[model samples]
Target: MTETVKEYLRIDGTEDDKLLGFLIDSAKEYLTGAGVKGTDSKRYELAVIMLVTHWYENREAVGKVLGKVQLGLQSIILQLKAEGLKSE
Candidate 1:
């Protein structure tokens, strides 16, 4: 049976929260590189879901490293978004 999309996406207000966001952005890039469409790639989705669960379970250790990475990524994304808004 096919696994349904996981609900952990709703997690908020922790270091893992930002890491999850970064993982999602990375997963989209990965899927695109593999020629997979977001709507049709169950395989990509499942892979991301599993990786997220692994991170969540190990957050005590992973969170410190991920938090630093996520902060940098979040800053970049915010800058891009600001530029886009200014351009429009």
Candidate 2:
């Protein structure tokens, strides 16, 4: 798990084990509270880890990225609506 986050963040070495473990725990807690229903896929788990790590590394970028992600999700919703597909 730490390896995945390290790879995503392009980090190397053994100096950040504690910090990465803490962030991994934080990511898990955050995802649990954020209603991630399943803990099955590695991709999903890695995404949460990457997001938390990104926020930890760059506080300012989180807002911008979040805004862009929200807008992208909104666009997807609109497209689905246009196609008469229901989105929960």
Candidate 3:
């Protein structure tokens, strides 16, 4: 998952591996708390990767919002939640 996120972010170093891993876990927890247990593998993985990218790029507490990331994350979360409901 770290590798996937790193590739997605075009990161070429291992120094941030630990931070990336932590972000992945945090993303999973956030999804779970938002009712997106992510039964769909691709969606789940993508969500995690997307979140890690967002967090990695915006480590500072105060920063301008990146275009599409905020909207895309919300959209993916909604999709995951809807799928979870359907499966249930």
Task: Please state every model's RMSD to the true fold in angstroms.
Answer: 12.1, 6.1, 2.6
TM-scores vs. true structure, each candidate:
0.39, 0.59, 0.83
What ranking of all candidate models by TM-score puts the best one first? 3, 2, 1
Q: Please give the range of 10 consecutive residues that has the lowest summed lDDT in model 2.
A: 78-87
Query: Clash number for every model?
Result: 0, 0, 0
Write candidate 2's Cα lDDT for 1-88 as tens digits.
8887888788889788777877777656655554453345554565566556666676666423365444543453344334333324
What lDDT would each prediction earn against the true structure?
A: 0.48, 0.59, 0.78
TM-score of 2: 0.59
**Model 2 misplaced stretches (Cα beyond 4 Å):** 59-66, 69-88
Q: By TM-score, is 1 or 2 better?
A: 2
Give model 1's clash tally: 0
Residue pairs with backbone atoms closer than 3 Å in model 1 (clashes): none
Error of 3 at 85 (Å): 1.0
- The true-versus-predicted C-alpha distance at residue 81 of model 2, in Å, is 20
Error of 1 at 57 (Å): 7.2
lDDT of 3 by residue, 1-88 (tens): 7888888998898898998888888888878887887564797888788777777888983122356876887888898788778877
- Provide the global lDDT of candidate 1 against the true structure: 0.48
